[model samples]
Target: MKPEAKNETQEMHRVEMTIGTILRWGVIVAAAIMIVGLLFYLVDGSLGVASNYHVQNFHQLLQGLIAGKPYAIMMVGIFALILTPVLRVVVSIYSFYREHDRLYVIITSLVLLILLTSFVLGIEFQL
Candidate 1:
């Protein structure tokens, strides 16, 4: 193996490590956010009422977040957890494209498309 090929391999490994670190930190941050929200809810004495499982609209959720609503913060944390995998897929798409891996780029693009389609449908159907 040539030194150039070894360097390329190292670069790919670094990219993979970076993506892995991003996912790990994403989950950690999301969990911390959720924990804080839970603590806030408990401290605020909102646990007595039954919490609805309805998904809040993004705009409303953002407003609630600005208003310091615990539930809204929790929902935002959930969204971050959900987005981690989508972010991974996007990163993979870019990596494959840079490597000129046509097949992988197409496959990863399809995965991304499906993920986005599901999110849109979920919002539209309120599911």
Candidate 2:
């Protein structure tokens, strides 16, 4: 292979590895947060009553988090989990842009746009 092509291949490999690492760490961190929250709930003996609990919005989530609410912590973990793939899409867009792959960059950007749009509409409609 030409040296230029080989270097480009290696760069792509590195980007893939970075993306993999991001996904791995994102899941691991989210799971850890959720586990900690679960443990707190178990210790507090609030598991039974948790069903009726609701966090109305981000502001409430923040307040609950500040007050050390286990459910709020769990919600944050859930948010992180949901965002992992969105992050991957964002990274893919950047990677494609770096490689001058306009088609892929556009495709990935559209995927990201769809993801964000769905998230917004889901929240707006409370779905």
Candidate 3:
């Protein structure tokens, strides 16, 4: 194979590996956070508190986190879990753009736009 083609292949492989590592670490970190939150809840004797707790927005979430609220910590973990794939999509868009693959870049961009729109609409309609 031409050296240029080989280098491109290696670059693509590296990108794929980086994406995989991001996904793996994202899940691991999220799970660890959730476990810590569960442990806090269990030890703090707040078993039923989460049932009544609702975080209204990022501000509230941050406040609760600062106050050492277990549910807030768990919510953060959940958010991280949800964002993992979205991050992957973002990375894929960058990877395709780097490779000059316009078709995939456009497709992934649309996917990201749809994801963001859904998030906006969901937040707007949320009670």
Best by lDDT: 3
Per-residue lDDT of candidate 2, residues 1-127 (tens digit): 9999999999999999989999999999899999988998888777323676776678988988887788888999999999998899998999999999999999999999999999888877872
74: Cα error in model 3, Å: 0.3
Off by over 4 Å in 1: 47-53
Please give the range of 10 consecutive residues that has the lowest summed lDDT in model 3. 47-56
List per-prediction Cα lDDT, in the order shown: 0.85, 0.88, 0.90
| lDDT score, candidate 3, position 75 | 91
| Model 2, residue pairs in steric clash | none
TM-score of decoy 3: 0.93
lDDT (Cα, tens digit) per residue for candidate 1, span 7-86 = 87997998799789879989998999899889989889773234665644888778778877788889889999999888
Counted clashes in each candidate structure: 0, 0, 0
Please give each candidate's TM-score: 0.90, 0.93, 0.93
